[model samples]
Target: MPRERILELRHRGRSFREIARETGCGYGTVRRAYWGAGACAAATERSG
Candidate 1:
């Protein structure tokens, strides 16, 4: 699944397990995606 879709789902209050199930990904994948994206966003905010 796309990162944007995953983030959108997460923004809507879905749990990691729920996102994994809906996106056909493993729980770890969903969790890592969220974390990785957050880290990138934080880095960008700090730099920008």
Candidate 2:
């Protein structure tokens, strides 16, 4: 749920800090979620 929210916020052009604040997560947490999900998506796209 949070990963999706984080991605949504990112897609809306929110910075990591803003995402963290909006989502009530730490900056590192938001960054990790965004990058981790993004990496997975990229890998899936490449493989697919």
Leading candidate by lDDT: 1
Query: All models: lDDT?
Result: 0.66, 0.64
Q: How do all models score by TM-score?
A: 0.66, 0.64
Cα RMSDs of all predictions? 8.9, 8.8
Q: Which regions of candidate 1 fall more than 4 Å away from where they truly are?
A: 37-48
How many clashing residue pairs, candidate 1?
Answer: 0
Clashes of 2: 0
lDDT, candidate 2, 1-48, per-residue tens? 246767887889899898666656667767777877432333234435
lDDT of 1 by residue, 1-48 (tens): 556766888889999899777656678777777876432233234435
In TM-score terms, candidate 2 sits at 0.64
21: Cα error in model 2, Å: 0.6
lDDT of 1: 0.66
